[model samples]
Target: MKNKLAAGLLGIFLGDFGAHKFYLGKPKTGLLYLAFCWTAIPAILGFIEGVSYLLSSEENFQAKHGRKY
Candidate 1:
């Protein structure tokens, strides 16, 4: 889950390429975010998603994305 954590943290800090999405096994989303990263929307949204993930409960995460480990 390190990747996911990194992605969420980095994504919020540096989500130009949807790093969080990539970490979550959503390469397509990551690419999409990367495409629009220059606009800075992805970065903002990434940060939000990152924080959400960081604050989310383990059970919620597992229920939503399953055991990525």
Candidate 2:
């Protein structure tokens, strides 16, 4: 199971490299984010996603990611 705190922090800090995506077992999506990382879009989006993750209800997070925080 994924740790929401870890994932959220990774998304906020290392998300430009798609660290959170990798942690979530999404290698393909992680690669896509890495490919576009130089554009800075991935970082911005990652930050938003990180915030979303931090704010999400645990049940909702589990339902979406199929794992517990």
Candidate 3:
């Protein structure tokens, strides 16, 4: 998806279930996040991660998301 902002927002909002992590191809981390999601740590961290994603440059985001130039 081109809209990293939208995905990041969704990650912040629904990252408790590791939805964002899944979308980003981090299934292992996503599962862990999902497992401990009830603690709210994943949610908070996911929100911060989302904001960081938004703040990062496009090339950086593409790399994180596994996109090619």
Candidate 4:
């Protein structure tokens, strides 16, 4: 299972390169983010996603991601 803390950290720090997406088993989206890493959009989105992950309930995260972190 993926770890929420790890994923959140990755997203917050290396999310421009889609590290968190890869960790979450979303290679396609990860590649997309990587391809667009030159833009600031990925970083902004990643930060939001990271914070959302950290704030979300565990059950909600599990239900959405299909596994516990």
Q: Give one clash count per candidate, in the order shown.
A: 1, 0, 0, 0
Off-target runs (Cα >4 Å) in candidate 3 are 1-3
Over 1-69, each residue of candidate 2 has an lDDT whose tens digit, in order, gives 677888899899989989889988899999999999999999998899888988998878778775545
In terms of TM-score, which candidate is stronger, 1 or 3? Answer: 3
Model 4 regions lying over 4 Å from their true place: none
Q: State the local distance difference test value for candidate 3.
A: 0.80
Worst 10 residues of 1 by lDDT: 1-10
The models' CA-based lDDT, in order, is 0.76, 0.87, 0.80, 0.88
Q: What is residue 49's positional error in candidate 4, in angstroms?
A: 0.3
- What lDDT does model 1 reach? 0.76
Worst 10 residues of 3 by lDDT: 1-10
Q: How accurate locally is residue 46 in candidate 3, as Cα lDDT from 0 to 100?
A: 86
- What residue pairs are clashing in model 4? none
* Predicted candidate 1 versus true structure: per-residue lDDT over 9-58, tens digit per residue: 87678777787787777799889998997897887898888888778877
Better of 3 and 4 by lDDT: 4
lDDT of 3 by residue, 1-69 (tens): 446876688687887778778888779989999899889899988888888878888877877685546
